[model samples]
Target: MDKHFLIVSFLFCFIVAVTPLKCVTCHLRTRTDRCRRGFGSCIAQTFESCMSLKIFQDNILQLSYMVCQKFCRDLTFDFHNRTYVHKCCRYNYCNIEI
Candidate 1:
């Protein structure tokens, strides 16, 4: 009985340690330089990162958004002379500045 209890306790600890955290989700966009207020709930899943993205056009900032992400490479991409800035974080609701 002692051995069984020890094994069960270890398994429970491992499960709790590996579980993912919940993160807030929201997107903000505006062509006129004003984004409306929005509210969102936390999402708990296998995703281990929260990401914030910002895009700019002709030195004028365009879109801003945030989402729970599965991968976290922390890189940026550009297309059609437009730039994409990507940032990743590990804490819950840490994808601010979007």
Candidate 2:
């Protein structure tokens, strides 16, 4: 029983250790922005989407690359879904429909 408990504990710890620190939805939005949008609107749109999801709205500055990885995993964005905006310089943004 003790050995079984140890194995279970280790597995649980591994999962917790690998789990993303940032919220999943926010991560998805962030990754989508990175693959599609340049930077400016990516930050703004991701921030707003994170706010709407009630996840990491106030902690954008503290976000790490790992959390961003979580976003990339959850998002299905790619080169095709990207759109260009011509406000001044050519800018791009992801068009995640769902």
Candidate 3:
């Protein structure tokens, strides 16, 4: 009985450890800061992380995008009078507040 219990416990731990991270996903956010389209959740793969991207035009926020990104990197850039900020996180739902 002890051996069986130990094996089951170990398996449960292993499964939990190997489970992929979950992240909030939204493709478009409205001006009122509400999800406008593609609202859902995603399970991140081994090479992926949760990413949030915010776009600002003339210092006013214009859009927000969130998803599970592969090979994610933190960055900020400007293009065509708009600034884009990209942020990445590893834990589950870490990008929720971004």
Identify the candidate with maximal TM-score. 3
lDDT of 3 by residue, 12-94 (tens): 99998998899999999866989999899999998999999999999999999999999999999999999999999988899
lDDT per residue for candidate 2 within 1-98, as digits (tens), equals 99999999999999875543332222323533342222222332232221211123233322212111112223322233342221111112222221
* Candidate 3 wrongly placed segments (more than 4 Å): 1-16
Please list all clashing residue pairs in model 3, or write none if there are none.
none
Q: In what order do the candidates fall by lDDT, top score first? A: 3, 1, 2
Compared with the true structure, all predictions reach lDDT values of 0.71, 0.30, 0.93
CA lDDT, candidate 1, residue 51: 78
* Ten contiguous residues with the weakest lDDT in model 3: 29-38
**Measured by TM-score, how close is model 3 to the native structure?**
0.81
What's the alpha carbon RMSD for model 2? 15.1
Q: Model 2 misses residue 43 by how many Å?
A: 12
The C-alpha stretches of model 2 lying farther than 4 A from their native spots are 23-98
Per-residue lDDT of candidate 1, residues 11-96 (tens digit): 99999778676555657856564554443645556645777777878867787766777775577788898888888877667776
- Superposed by TM-score, candidate 2 places the C-alpha of residue 83 at a distance from the truth, in angstroms, of 38
lDDT of 2 at 92: 24
